[model samples]
Target: MANEVVVVMVPFLAQGHLNQLLHLSRLISTYNIPIHFISTATHNRQVRIRLHGWNPNNNLIQFHDLDDPIVTPHPIIPNTTSHPNFPTHLQPYFNSSLLLRTPVADVIRSVSQTARKVAVIHDSLMSYVVQDVCLIPNAETYIFRGLSVFYYFCSTNMNLGRELPFEPDKICQLPAPGESISPEFSEFIKLQYDHQKNHVGNVYDSSRIIEGKFVESLKRDQVNGKYHWAVGPFNPVEMDSDCLDRHICLQWLDKQPARSVLYVSFGTTTTFTSDQIAELALGLERSTQRFLWVLRDADKGDGSVGVKAAGPSHEKPLFDNYQTLHSTCRSVGLPEGVAGRGLVVREWAPQIDILGHLSTGGFVSHCGWNSCMEAMTAGVAVATWPIHTDQPYNAILLSNVLGVAVVMRDWEHRDELLTSVMVEKVVRKLMDTEVGEAVRKRAAELGGEWRKSMADGGVTHEDLNSLISYIHK
Candidate 1:
């Protein structure tokens, strides 16, 4: 008998990247195709622990954990007057991740031998790990983008020889007019860009309904002869009963009126100074709107890499530094008066569950693409506070192009502390004003359109089918 075609997924170590590819894996598995998901042991465990939408154990996807890479310490420049705009703290993790290329290549080679064709789908940043797949006669590689297609188009417009429709400042990934990039982070970016040159096709965690104009624009502008698929809003439509019961926040949400509570979270990678956190709390208290906020210290080490042996020497020291900077953030207490109307979670909150709840009226988000998609799909308006990377671009998409969100703080002002008065103003506008009502209605309409894109004959459905058929071929 002929061996069946096999699909392999390789995601970057970050939670956002891992979660998207895992969701995609679940979607692809429904077609009866066996999938092998390869990653470091720690990241695989993290994804498994936090997995929702589907039960991982019952799925057709198999987890293959690779040995952990040895962690090396990057030199710390003490008393530096200027800090890099990028998250240079993650450099050690990035340096170690590069070592996985040999082992990842081995996994792909071994899996290709047993299958008629091996389709290796990797995160955009992880192309280096699977670069050798082209040498395998029966293996093909596809780059999975975790950001919105619109952000991709805008970021690459100049390189693609297309004139930008918006001002250069609008692309937040680029530095401000006078700002300078640190050499350390600049090298890191250059390395990632070099790794991206080897993919055969592109896979986006976005839908035509969300970015139809950009999708068509990219198709016409790029002459690379590579196929692009917009298969997204990968998050499941409804949370299972078990998932609902697991999070206590949902029970509190049950008591609130529909469209009354604001859900606040800044994603896993963002950290705030104590004064900023205090101002945020004061603002929420002053707004007097019912709210649910997820507050946690940013992950100090590599976001997801778990060292298998004893912790690296640099790990504890780096964590110590984070503690010093954010010590007040952890202990700064919210006012007693706000407790009656607000709920604050110090651990991971069931973000998707909370966003999908009927009580959730608006989201105060960092505008991460995954969070943006979840909010859009749930028909919730957003109060954008974009921090870095593609977040500013996503904020623009929601607040400007989509008209489903309002900007609380733009990336240009990320370093400045936000005062309580400003916070109260934004929160009240999102919750009590007629403008808020209009934004909510638009969000619901867009959400309906996004859902239709995944229905039986919708654009996303068709694109997903096309992807699977290509794998089978």
Candidate 2:
């Protein structure tokens, strides 16, 4: 063990970024490599808690707390939730990352003192890591692309103004009709590359596409001398947590017929207007299909859609909470009489377990990368309702290119919140009948292939070995 290598994993503060990177780290540990996971105290504690729950090989995984000197003292808006007419508040987080140069660099220096090869694996969004972490004398730096391979292709070429086949102005969907992006794709490219110049690291993406036609297209891209190393779609298997009643839902699911239930959840940051949530709630009820929806209470804070102020004229006590809203669901637009068919998971739901259940047939998701991978890994086809960021693009991949999901609405499709009537139709198509059955079979087949591909002699397994070899050098 004298020559054992140690790595540092630095994920952006967001929940999605942390989850993916943690899984990636766990996967790396299976090869018997040790890793030091670094983040703010709050986030590191959360990761520690989650890892302890998984009961993995703990000796290989260590957590370090980095103090955010700048933002620790400053609380900009009293409210952390997303609000109308307020400026986007992401700049503060970016500022905090830049300020971590001292503590993070010190950690690097301490690790370099040991008799081991050291490397830093960081989220692409962390501009400071590229600026500072690479400066550490002997440690190599690599970026973990938490986004899809599709985004990587678009970001690289689009930065070079390489005349992409798809129009940059429109939301870049896959095969057929699709949605649009914010700030547009081209602009997004320039801003990112500006921070990425002169960086020291290899690029690693979470995409599972490297084994498919995407590999060929990626080869073509590499001819231009820009390349990303594939060590992923680092899919998570068997999630367990103290957050919810892990057994109740699964026990209830066992009684349902095969492919009978649809699982619905938007990731942590996703939110909807009251009108939209009501429409969605009623849609589940009216669809008459067994479903589990994790409509968490908005009052918990963080960025989520909030209800508008009610006028004095309306006698109804404005619906401020999901639990209360559930009680009088009819007042807020749920269809009458369907409680027995659906369960509202307000605490937390073991997402991976639920997805893997035989009774779970379909997913109605916001098309986040982690959620998409989970559904694919579990062989559950999806009903896409993308909300923002890279989601519209993810939806296209699932519904169009992969043929594993069907898009109900792109992220920006907001003429008005979709009515319950619209919801029922989409749910039915995803859960019951000829089209759903076909997609379900396709998803299962792909899942089997992906699992095989991650095993011994598989594509990702080899790529991971290559990554480790690269770090050793």
Candidate 3:
């Protein structure tokens, strides 16, 4: 009888995590392992809409949705740019991880009867609960850190006492840029770690659990244990060019001058209020730099309080120029002359092609993991503007540690209070400053390093193969 393998992926309630887990599933399923992707009901709807058209019902790939306790209380928040309700209102899903473990375990048990073994890939932030659940029979667990190798390297070496990884209080000598992380960025790193740590409870206990798991996995690898995998990002077992789209932004990019355009996006899951949108717009315009901005539509939950049909419409008047915008797309509004300024404001542009374009010189981004990876891979320097969650942390590492990026600010607010002056300063620095040039050079070099990391017999490739071998043992 052929041995079967079942893999369970439990990700945080965020788009970045969802994308990463799905990519991992795609990689492992190629080995003929049965993969079951688990997510909440709302997230499942999102997957169905965005990724469903891509063909998900193949023999090896399947998806499942679990119950969400706060479903009714948490109405779906729509994103004008990316898929709807993605990263905006992050419901308290940490409390639900344990609640989700049983249903997931039962699914694994049912699949394992016909399969050879079972594996669980847990996002690093939720590793504690996922690992606990994996004490079940034939189940192995691994933590997936959705960050770059640079950030990972910095994190592994952080000590919170004498020297915090990113505390502003230290005014001491800055850590080396690109070669090492500076104290300026370390405060944000430490803050992000604390935010995640708080969700899991006492830091000491959490560290103990994490350390113990690593030690056990190392020992298992020594004797070739059945429950160990150190996989990071995924690679196409075969690079089928046909599987990718080729003609959209690349053709446009082939015509523009190098280092002239700024690529702008807030990521698939993050959302901002209309005021914040205007502030950002003014910033972009005042900076006098040409850019491609992906703007999210207005969120209607707050205004939809009592009206049945007028949901987000009630709040539309708040935007001064909205009267000019037709509801043709799920947009809040576009300021006058926005279309004439060499700006591309589409909901979704061919990102891969755009990034690959020679004309695309820099990125003004939300510092999401996938975006960071894509930008680095494209050799594009970045103007980092982080919002919520791990974005600030990622921004710090990218700007201060790697020297490939520059941060606008680490603070985020729902109100549209930031003046146009702030945006002008950031935009000018990204487009014309000497700092920007240095960052661009370093980014190009790192992009090459990233390609090397995933090439055959590279660090990431070896890691993935070792993970697969460890699990099959």
Candidate 4:
């Protein structure tokens, strides 16, 4: 019966979204179902190269590559400046994604012919790609939300003209739909929103242990009797050998004391101004904590490119490659004395491995959902520094509701420059103070609960079983 069903995954073209759906595909494939993971050729290649925790060469999960869409070059904003327009710069990418509708529909149709039931699961933002799924008699469509149920609940309430039960901070209050995006992108967003209204249900990269109340609230408040499932912290429980070999950060982490090092990263979509980077560097130094910082520019959709390290300064830096460390320190304008205290990586780091390592105590993050899930699963507390989109809401959930993180800056103040003094204070608060310890303890407890939820007979496992059964019926 399982072999008579096929799952088709259509993930949005960003790292966070792509990674979650890929993890979902793996989970679904384990049930003996054939899975088709479709995306542009370039994106498929990117997934293959960056995939960890599992081999992409598995027989049950197959990659279906669509031709790349012709997109104009987006303007390259300098790394030294803040991106005020933010995601508007991603308009070209969004526009290009719409062009995949026909090809995606074609794939769904072809697969439906062989399978008794074709399950089309798409990222919420990519719903337009599979809008025609309803036209196929044997196919059903589901939306995959790559974020917390808490964020979605609040946002949906606001969109429906319902008032929030509790007062929210300015940053936590979500912007109205299409308010912050380009007109072209706004139209694209509308299409997805329209298509979402007719979907069967939602699949979240979240779990009840993290947001049980919110999940229940969404279920009760849903108007059409639609159902949803929380089967997430989508990263695998066991680390594969391939993940261990991907980065030098893991080797450096090996020498640090347990619960000592801070892992700092702003995700793939966020980039700090040069001044902001300098302030952060100085702050990490003043806090006197051992840190591993992944510093890179926002991905521009072309491909990953290495950032050039600058020349050496007077102080000696700590990596195996002294020259590279010295150059990284000089480039980021770190204080000479900070050389031995930190490691700055210019490319992608194995985040899952780093977080899962015993030495990692806290995270300085943009509070993207994927990062939040990774930190939670690894039992590391966070210093929340949200940039845009649903991040502010995730930050609020982490700091205000869950009590697993500390707020470094509010989204309302994201445009203002954060000074080194404030950075040092926040870093110290999250790393050296009693407050930090309390949050760390709570985070560890939550991590334990979430892990169990993924075990047999737990909430996540049952949810996965329910979803598979739904498809089979």
lDDT of 2 by residue, 1-473 (tens): 34357888878866678777887788788777788888877666554443322654489888788764444322222111243211123434544555665777788777777736777887777655445655666676776777767655555565576655655444344322212332333243344555565444444544344234554466675544543467665656555534464445666677788878898888654445555666777788778888977664321122222222122232122233323233322212222365456776543456777888878889999888878878887878999986655676678678767889876775444344677998999998877778888988898888887777777788866777777777777
What is the lDDT of every predicted structure here? 0.77, 0.63, 0.55, 0.79
lDDT of residue 18 for candidate 1: 88
- Candidate 1: tens digits of C-alpha lDDT, residues 1-473: 13589889999877888899998888898898888999988778888877766788855788999987777644332112244434455567666767889989999898888888989999877877777888899989888988988777876775456667876555543433224334664565567766666577889988888898998888886787778899887788777856434566777788899989999998766655555666787798889999987766544444342211112332232222221212222222245565556876665666888988989999999899999999999899999987667777788899888999988987666667788999999999989999988998999999988888798999989999999998898
Query: Which candidate would rank higher by TM-score, 2 or 4?
Result: 4
Residue 302 local lDDT, model 3: 22
Q: Model 3 scores what on Cα lDDT?
A: 0.55
Alpha-carbon TM-score of each model against the true structure: 0.88, 0.81, 0.70, 0.91
The digit string of per-residue lDDT tens for model 3 on 352-385 reads 5566667888888877767776677677888876
Error of 1 at 458 (Å): 0.7
Off by over 4 Å in 2: 1-3, 50-53, 68-91, 155-211, 222-227, 238-248, 297-336
TM-score, model 2 to reference: 0.81
Residue 244 lDDT in model 3? 49
Best by TM-score: 4
Worst 10 residues of 2 by lDDT: 78-87
| Candidates arranged by TM-score, highest first | 4, 1, 2, 3
Which candidate has the highest lDDT of all?
4
Candidate 2, residue 50: how far the Cα is off, in Å: 5.0
- The superposed Cα distance between candidate 4 and the true structure at residue 304, in angstroms, equals 2.7
Q: Candidate 4 on 348-410: residue-level lDDT in tens?
A: 667888898889999999898999999998888999987767787888889988999998987
